[model samples]
Structure formats: C-alpha cells, structure tokens
Target: MTTDARALVPLPRSGPATAAGTRFRLHRAGIQNVWQYDEQEFAFGDGRLLLRGKNGAGKSKALEMLLPYLLDGDSRALDATGTGRTTLAWLMLDGFEQTNRLGYLWVEFRGTTDGGDHRHLTLGAAIRASRSTQKALPTFFVTPLRVGEDLHLVEGGKPLPVDRLKEIVGSDNITDRAVMHRSRVAPELFGITDATRYRNLTQLLHRLRRPTVGDRIEHGGLASLLSETLPGLDEDVVEKVARNLHDLDAVRDELGRLERTDTALRTFLTSYRGYLSGVLRTSAQAVSRELEVLAQRRRAAGDAAQRTSELRTQEEESEARLETLREEEEAARTDLAALHDSHAYRSLHELSEHRSTVEAVHTAAGAAFTALSNAHGAEEGAAERLADGVEHLGSRLAELGTEHRELLTQAEMAGLPTGHLGEAVALPRTVRSQTVETQLTAPDGETHTVQQRSVVRVDTATVQDGLGSWQLRPGHALPDGPTLASALRPAPQPGCGVTAEQVERLLTTIALAPAAETAAHDAVYHDGSWRLGILSGRHHKADA
Candidate 1:
C-alpha cells in the first residue's frame, strides 16, 4: 500500500495517559489530603520504587497513580481547578481488600520527525456515578497527566479530556482487555505477581456461606473441569449426591421389573382363559353325546316309570331319615342344657367351675378344628393356582426358549448382534425376527462386519400385517429396477382377493396413497430372492 493510503487510515488519537514511547519521572508521589493513611508523600528518583503499607494505610491508591506516572506518565491526581476543593474525576481513588489493582495505565509517546525526541504521558481512570448522565449511571473518566518542556504540568494536560483519551486507550471500561492488561502489567512490573493471593495472605481467611443450587451448578461448570487435574475434589457431599442418584436409579429399575411381571401375568391369563374355554366346550360336547346315547337306549330298558317312582320314594325316605337325625340332635342339645341347669351341674360348677371349663375346652377345640379346615382350604386353592401358573409359565417359557434359539441361529446366519434384547428372545413365544448387517472396508483394504438386531416385540405392531408382506419385492415389480439390475425378477400380486387398482382406490379414499400416482422403483432383484433395495446407483432416492 502507498504511504498516502496507509496514512489515510484514521489514526487513533493519542493521550498522555497511554502515549507511545514515553518514560515518566516522579520526584515524589502521594495522596495529599485524606485520612491518617492520607496526606502522605514519598520522593523517588527516576527509575522505579516499591511502596508498601499496612491495611488502611492508603498505599494502594497511591500506587495506582504512581504506577501510571512511572510507566505511562498519567496519574488520576486531584488538582485545584477551584478554591478550597479539587475537581475529583475518579469514582474510587481509594484502595480496599476487593479493589481491582489493574485500573492504572501509563504510556510512552515518540515523535516521528527526526530530532523530535520522545515524551511520556500517563493515564489513570476510575468510575464515578454522575447524576448529570441519564439514569444516574457511572461514567468513567480518564485523567491524563503530561510532563512538558518546562518539567511542569502543561496547559490543558493535567486533567486531560477523558473523551479523547479513551479513544487512544481503546476503552476506559475496567472490564476491557486493554485496560485490564494495563492494570495487570503495572502490578506485575512491581513484583506483585499474585495480587489475589497477596490480598488473602494479608487478611484472615474465613469460610463463606454455603452455595445455593444455582451457585453449585456454576461452581460445577468451572471447578469440575479442574477436578481431573486436581486431587481431593470428590468430598463427602459429592459422594452423597452420587449415592442418592444411584438409589433413585435402583428404585426405577425395581418399578420396571414389577411392570414387566404384571404384563407377563396378564399375557398368561389371556392364554389360560382361551385354554379353559376350549376344555369346557370339549367336555360339554362329550356329555351331550353320552346323553343322546342313553336316550336312544332308554326304550329297551324296562320299568322306566317304576324306576322313577322308586327314586321319588328313596328321596322321601332320605328326607325322613335326615329329619329324624335332626330331631335326635335337638333332643341331645336340650338334654345337655337341662343337665347344665340341674343341681348336679350347679354343684360341679361350684367345685371348679367344671361346666364352664368344659364349655371353654369345647369352644377351643371347635375353633382349632375350624381354623385348620380354613387353612387347609386356603392352601388347596393356593396350590392349585400355583400349579396352574407354573405349568402355564413353564410351557410358555419352553416355547420362548426354543424360539429364541431359532432366532439366535437366524441372527448368527445374518451376522447380527446378540444380547441386544435380553431374555425376551429366549422367552416362550417369538412372533418374528428381523436383523440388518453392514460390512465396512478399511483404508488398508481389510473388511469388517457390523450387525444390527431389531427385536420384533410380539404385539400389535408385529402382528398388524403378516411378516411375509415384509419380504423383498422382485426387481421387475419396480419402475427403475429392471433397467439397472443385471438380473430381472417379477413379483406376483398378493392374494388379497382385490385388484391393485382397488387397493389403490381404498388407500386414496383413506388419504394414504394420493390419487396422483407416479411409477417409482422400490426394489432391485440381485440374488436368488428379489433385492428390496430402495436406493439405486444413480437415480433412486430414499423415502423421507
């Protein structure tokens, strides 16, 4: 680029605070008017000096101005622009525990002309809440200090115009990289390498309040990254949170197991109900057949009416016998009651409450016998239920095992992954099997195989259409397949008792297949079976 063109680029205005190629000399630097820490001054020669003070001694604020004067030749020094008071532009010309140390800057300025020599300008800035600004916001002011030809403050240079100075500093904002780096460079230049550590060391450290949930998340984001490099991070609280998450997962797993068991039970009940219905129907049929045979043979059997009459007579005699037995039982009970009411019974009761004792014994015996009988009945029911359940479970389980074995064999043949779905494949019943395999060639020309197994869960989705419907279609059946494939195969229409047009019409009626149909190839015949490869080498595209 031409010199004129280079010069045409707008040059950033320079200020004494950050003037390039300048060295500043401070004969003495200190805060003039302030507390016991203030009204202190120290004189140092040209190069550099270290200033130290105890807490509340006001050394840091002095350092802020002095460093700028030494490095860039700018100090945020208060000067008497008016009577009795100085025009203070800095928001904070004070130092404290948490104050940012890198807010001070100094710059050196050099003249391009030969024999122009160099000059130093120092710039220091601080935030001040200005009521004159909108919303009472804090406005930053850069105070530029310049030492001139007479070795005294130059005109219009002491409290330099902040607006023009900020343009050279890039920004007066404390958060800006230029300002922050300048501030940091000053402290490091003065051997304050670890400013934060220095501050902590100077004070008694105390534990802060516990972190809130949001604070913890933020801490995890930043501090967790350091954990791999740092030790002693996984403390007791961290382990406890991990343990709680683990327990929650265990409970979720238990609940899943229960749901699976419940599903299995329902499945078993469905099959059992079907089996019982079949058995009852068979038994009813057999009973009906025997009755029919007896009816046919009944005419040859003599004295049918006599047999009927005899049966009625036997029924009456049995009724009479039952009535007599009942009368005897009632009479026995009455006699026992009378015996209890008699003097002898009263005498026995007086002896040792014998009648009451015998009654208690009898009641105890009856209760024991009744309890045993109820327990036996409950046990019998439970045994029958358990037996039915086990038998059903075993048969289904065996069937599933066999099916699983078959599927595993098929999956092996297909080179599919095993153990993708556990236990179900080896369960009592398997409706269908579908698996996909992929072969990959390495850069070295070595081939590797990867298999994908899709378990066909036996339910509505698996049984919606026959698995045979999912078989690969012939190449000739598709529009583009015949032209591309080496071998051509034709597909037979499905035997659904309906023409393709009729099915198409039905699909259109239901808004499935649109009325406007295009001839698109869906398959290509390659092996003995038609290859249902939907993609073609050139023109074929996949369904979305």
Candidate 2:
C-alpha cells in the first residue's frame, strides 16, 4: 500500500452508473488512534456496504468514524472511554472529477480531555493513491479557524482547541447541508440504511410539493382534495353550495321568527302550565329528600334520648353508692379521731412519761446508797468508841431515812407512788414515726388519706361454740402507726353499643313519602285520639 496525494471524487452509486463523475470514495477506514479499544477498519467500493463482526469487534466504531466524513465533520468524536468528548473530527473529501479516477477521502480526528484525563492521539489519514502518482504525501488539509484569527492548517505539529474547531464547523451547518444534498441515492449519508433511504426519497418529494398546498391551507386556503376528486367542483362550487344552504337556513329561521311573533294568551298559558309542572316535579323531589332527612333526625334523637336516659340511671345509682360511701367514710374518720383521744392511747403516753421519771429516781437512789455506805465505814473504837459508833450509826440511820423520804418524793413527782415503785410495769412504746404517706378513694368513690397514725386493733373472743373469733378494727389506739395505700377504684367506662357510625347508618335507613302534603295528612290521620273514663257511682256500675 502506498500513500498518494491524488485528488479523486467518489460518487454515490445512483448518481453515475460507471466509476466516472464520482467525487467521493472510502479507501481505508478505521477509528483514530486516540480511541483505546480494538482499531476497527473498513474498505469499501461505495454504496450499501455492511461491516459485520462480533461484539466489541468495533463494527459500530468503523461506521462511527465514516459517519463524520459524510456529515461534513459536524458529529462529536468519541473518547477512549466511549464518551462523546464534544470534539469535532474533520475528514475532508477532496474528490477530483476525472475519468477512471481512483479516489479516497482522508479522515483526521482530534482527541479531547475526558473525565479529567488527557487522551493521546495518533490519528492516521487515508487518501486515494492512483497507480501512477503513488507516494508518501499529505492528501487532506485540516484547518482550525480560531477566535479573531484566520484559518490555519492543523498539521501533526500543533493542534488547535477542539471546542473552537467544533464551533466553526457546527455554525456552518456543514453536516446538515451535506445530508440534504446527498440524501437521494446515499441514504442521507448519516446512519444510512435501505429503509431510511426510501423514507428520505418519499420525504423529499413531499417537501418539494408541500409549499403549494401548504400555502393555500395556511392563507385562506381551499379544500384542494375535495376539489381534485370532484373535477368540476372548484372554489365557485363551494361558494354556490354555501350560499344555497345559507338561503334555506334563512328561510327556516324567518319562519321560526314569524311564528314567535304571535301573542296568543291561551297558547302562552299552555306553555306556562308545562313549565310550572316541571318546576313543581323538581321541587317535590327535593322536599321528599328533606322529609326523609328530618325523619332520620327524629329517630336518631330518640335513640340519643334512650342512651342519655340509661346514662342518667347509671349516674343515679353511682350517686347513691357514693352517698353510702360518704357516710361510711365519715363514720370511719370520726371513730379514728375518737380512738386518737381514747384512754388506751393517752395512757400509753402517760406510762412512757412515768417510766422516764422513775429512771431519774433510780439514778438518785443509787447515789444516796453509795454515800450511806461511805458514812458507815468512817466510824471506829471501844467504850468511848461504842458511844461514838452509836451516835455515828444513829446519824447514818437518820441520813438513810432522809434519803428514803427524798426518793419517795421523787417517785411521787414521777407519778409513781412508793408502794408501786417496786412492782414491774410495762408501758406502751412507739416503734415507728407518724406520717400521711398516701391518699386514695374508697369502693364507693370517696377520697381519703392514709396516715402512719392508723393501726389495726385485733381482738380474739371465745364464743358459745368454743371457737375464738378474730376481729380486726382500724384505729389509732394501738401501739403501732397507721398503714396507707395510693389510688382506688376506676371510674365506670361508657357502654360500647352507641357509636357515631351506627347513628349515621340509622339516619340513612329512614324513608319518607314522595308527596309531602299527602304524607303530612296521612301521618296526622294515622295518629288517632284515645279516651279514658272513671266510674264514681254505684248506680252506674250496677247498670253496667
């Protein structure tokens, strides 16, 4: 294979039957080196060529590369990652119109940055080389017309920005112009197929003839098809038919207008009667619905009244129970107070105070005994000693008597007499502190407080049957304090029978007569009078 720079024109198969007069050709086709996958290539004579391969064999890639050539390089080139990189790749067709020409178009593509990575491009260009002028020479010129600059050739040395090149080629409508011109035989050059080629031919014919009929339709147009099918029927026929219909309609309208001119009282009355009948029929239906609604309301009110009565009855019973509870609670409270003031409770307190006083007296007595013992040890001697000892003994005896009397006085002050001081006595004692720890309600719905001062007094008695009965009573007279609990019985819940949905169902079931007046009269008539009499005399009773 040799690289030749000969200019050759490759033409569509339909334009010229022979190879002469053809301006475009596909000699060697392949994806540019920038694409990192399988390098797909194609070589074709010209029309209706298919590139067939397995998946990922780059068959579509071959088509994609050649697609831009026919579209005047308006398509975006793909990156190595199969992304449309928004770069315009130009493949110029330098077709030479000559007999027996061997020509090919050269394709050159530039790579752009995709996904933040720069793509390397080693794009190869293909140009047709004749058997005569076959040499390694550049065939196609790739130019970049930059912003505020003239068009410069983009050779292998320096490549221009892909975006600037894209803007220029795209604004020129280069691809679309090529498509319109080459659409007839070459299947529009872009995504060409057999079916698409036929469709494009059909569309071209329609486009060429469209303006004539389309203009007429857009601007006060005629129905040309109807005119066409009916040869003699033109715009004049349409005007004549429309005028005839208008005249007949005018005559019929005038007759109706003339008929409405009459003011006959009897006829008016007849029409009025029919209109009033319709209005009355509608009014009656509405009233019947209203009557049905009212009846439903009455029934619902009755049901509500029954439920309210039941609630009241329950309330009355609850109130009675509450009253009983109040009385019982009041009695319990009063008894509790009396128990606090009872002799047993007060006696326990008195006994505690007396015991404390007795302890004080006992301590004083022990001190006195020690002093008496010391005084007895101090005396000694013989005859004179005997007199001294007797006098000392008498003095010590007097001191013992005085100490004894003082003890008696202290015992009396402590509320224990001298005779009772020697006896063993037990007194009531408190083991716990008093407190009102909780409040609660009784069985009958009364609230009461439980305090630490309360206690259960138990008494066991032998009955005639030889069995002992233990009775427990709550009071404040015991040695221990009261016990308390929180909370009480719950309030009674409402009945489950009555509900809003049930009431609505009942309201829906009510019925009323179609005629309101008739229904009212019948209802009143059905409710008859009732009479009652009293017998007061014996004579009237005898006659009966």
Candidate 3:
C-alpha cells in the first residue's frame, strides 16, 4: 500500500484549483537515492514545507529533482551550490567510488474540475549514476501515473533495471520527453500558459526562499502573478499602460525643445523691429527734405509765370503798333507810286539830262552873233573911208576936167594929143558897191534881223526870253510864247499833286519799311520814328 504525504503538511494553492484552470494541490513528493535518500517523502502544508536533515542528506538534491517537474524543466532552478552545473542529471548525487546507483523522484497532485470532479496524477523520473564516470544519466521514463497504477515499481529495495525501464518508455524518447512532459503538465497544474508568466512565478518562488532587496517585487511582478493567480485582472492592459508611459515621455521632451525654439524666434523679431524702425525714420527725413525743395521750386515757377504774362502783354502792344506801321508803310508806298507817275519828277529828270545841250547851243549862237556884229562894224568903217576917197577924187576930177576942157579947146586948136585923151574919163567908171543882209531864226520859226556894215550885233534879251520858258524848277511858270521852249517844258513840277517835302518823306518811309517790320516785335513807330518799350526787354530802331 502507498502512503499519502499530504496528511503530514499541505501547500496552499497559488491559484484556482480546477482541472482547466492553472491550479493544483501538491499532495506529496518522494525521492529514492542510493547515496542519500533511500526512500523519502516530503509533505506540503498550507504555506510551506520543511525538510530538516544533516549534511549530504540530499536536502538540495530533493529540491533539484522536484524543480524540473515543477517549473517545466527550467534548469536555472537546479543550480548546485559549487558545481557550476545545472542539469537534473548533474544535480543527482554520484554513488560511492566504484559503485553504481539508481535514483528517482515522484510528485503527486490533485486537481478539481469546474464540474467539481477531482483528478489525481503522479509525475515520475528515473536517473542512473556511475562511480567511474562520476555522472548521473537520466532515463526517459518520465511517465504520468494514477494512484493504483503499478509501472516500473519493484517489491524489495532493489533498483528497477535499465532494460525494464526502456521497455516501459522507449530509448528514442530519452532526448527531451521528461522536460517536454513537464511543460505540458504545467499549464494544467498552474493555470499559466505563457512562458514569461511561468518564469516570473518560478522566480517569485525562488526569491521567496531567499529574500533580498534586489529581488523585491515590482508592479510588473505583481501584475504577472495576479494575472495568473487572480480571476479578473488582464495582463495585456498592464503591458499597454507601460508602453503608453514611454511614448508620453518622448512627446514631453519634443515639446520642451519646441518651447526653446519659440523663445529664440521672439528674440530675433525684437532686434529686427528696432532695425526697421531706424530705417523708416531715415527715409522719412529724406522725404521731408525733398518736399521742401519741391516747394521752393514751385514758388520760383510762379514768378516765372508772372514774367511770361508781362511779356505776352508787351507782345500784344507791339503787334498793334506793327499793324499801324504796316498801314503807314502801305500809304508811303502808294505815295511813292504816285511820285513815280508825277510829271514834275519826270520833267526834272528830263531837264537835268538836257542842260548841257541847251548851254552849248546858246553859247554858240552868242559867239556867232558877236563875230558878225564886229565884222559889220569894220565893213561900215571901211565903206565910209572909201566913199570919202571917192568924193575927193570926184571933186579933183571935176576941177581937172574944167582945166582940161580949156586945155583941149587949146589943143584942138593945136590938135596934137586930143585924139589920145579920148574925151574926159568919168573916174574910171566908179567901182561897183553891194550891201549883204543876214537873219537869225529861232526854234519857233521867228526870225531876228542882223545887218553888217563890216560889223554884226546880236539881240541877247530876245534869246534869253525865248529859252527861259524851258526851266523845270518847282516854282517856275510856263512860258507864254510860241517857241520850242514852250513845247519842251510843261507846267513846272507838273502831274505831281504833293509837295516835294511830302514826296521825300514818303520815299524815306518806303526804304525803311522792311527793317521796321522786322524789328516791330518789340517796338512801335510813332510820328516818324521807332520807339521801343521797356517791358519788351529790347530796344532797337525800326530802321535798324
């Protein structure tokens, strides 16, 4: 008959006790060892189990054998004190020198289903130790058992043969079946399927065995434990909260950096504002100076406009004067035309041209008349002397004739020379005398008488009166005679109605008319001359 170890001491369940949930009650654990525990059973209580033994009594070895089954083959739980090895085979003690020994451990559990049915299970593993190799070797027979099953059990204190164990659990299953079987049983026994939660629970249990500050329980450890041990807490929510806290810290750091950048930007704007203010002030002053200059220019322009107005007024006055001058010029030209048509001017020109001819004719006529008069005087004197001589001769001849008559009477009486005397001669028949008469004719067919007795005389008053009618002076009168001079000279200054002075004035005005018109822009003609105005800014004679 088998003995139950739960009656000695019981361990409290870490979670719910149900077949589907991860909770179980450990009823007992037993170990059989060649060097230490020949056959030992440890019972669990509500909270703890105590095993009091001497040195080399397999106290730690018992825990090592139980750890592979409890924590699903987490070898870290089987670490020896000084061996530096962590395998359950290594954790098993070697037999005395030159001795072979067999070792095994078994743990039994009871679980309750949700339907209130209870199930009993037994987990077992076998190991072999060789003194020569000093190594413990695990058998693959890690089997699950019911309370009444009789497999790999012997009646006496002799060990189960390796062949019989291999017959029960095949050699091909030896590599990892013991550990894999524990992992499969752990979820059902503890209501924890996640490897991380299972690891935490095992660490919690180990830390509870030896308490330290480094092994203190944190919220994560508590959360993991509660997620498996308690009925209502969710593990995913706890993990999500932890991740959200990390993201929040990163965002807070980014926000701090942004605040510092914003402060720098504000400082830059302040400096820029001051600089812009200075620039604007300078620009405004420059604009003000320019405005003042423009104002001065505007005043000067007004003065210039006034001057222009005065100039325009002067221009208008000059234009009026020029118009009057143009009329005067036209009148002068008309007068000049009339003067050209005047008979007085024409007669003056003719008389001037013929003055030499008239003088020449008068001089020649005077000379000829003078010579004829001198010759006539000489002829008259000679005729008188001749007459005197002829008279004296006649008297003498008469006297002589009387004497001769007496002498002839005597001679006739003598009759000697009377025939040669031939009667008394009568002064040789008296030389014959003839008188020549001359006449002078004028251009009018009137004749003047000139008689010469060896001399001639001319009538000057008649010639003078005759030719005096041809004079062409301004106040000379026409001749009242039928002569060539009367025919040649018309009424003195004929055909000219104006006085000489007026004609001369008109001619002068015509000669200066063009110059007056050119300079008339700034001057005026008054009376008989050009007079410039001061407002026109120029002074010039119309005739200049």
* Alpha-carbon RMSD to native, per candidate: 63.5, 46.1, 42.6
- Residues 1-544 of candidate 1: C-alpha lDDT, one tens digit per residue: 0011121122232433333233333333433222222124354434334544445444433443334323322222222111213223232332222222112222222222245554333333322223233111122222233423322221243322335445544463323233344454344333355544433322211111112334645767435533322334358888998898879978999999999999999999999989999999999899899988888778546467778889899999999999999999999999999999999888877867776877787777566545544544554454344334434444544554555455445434333333431333111234233555657444344665644343222222222122223222454232232241212123323442433343333223223211111100111012101111111211131111
Candidate lDDT scores, in order, read 0.39, 0.38, 0.53
Best by lDDT: 3
Better of 1 and 3 by lDDT: 3
At residue 91, give the lDDT of candidate 2.
Answer: 22
**Candidate that would win on TM-score:** 3
* Model 3 ranges with Cα > 4 A deviation: 1-22, 46-48, 52-58, 68-70, 74-76, 80-95, 140-144, 147-149, 166-179, 191-193, 196-200, 210-544
Ten residues in a row with the worst lDDT in model 3?
527-536
The Cα error of candidate 1 at residue 313, in Å, is 99
Query: What does the lDDT come to for candidate 2?
Result: 0.38
Task: TM-score each candidate.
Answer: 0.17, 0.16, 0.33
lDDT of 2 at 407: 40
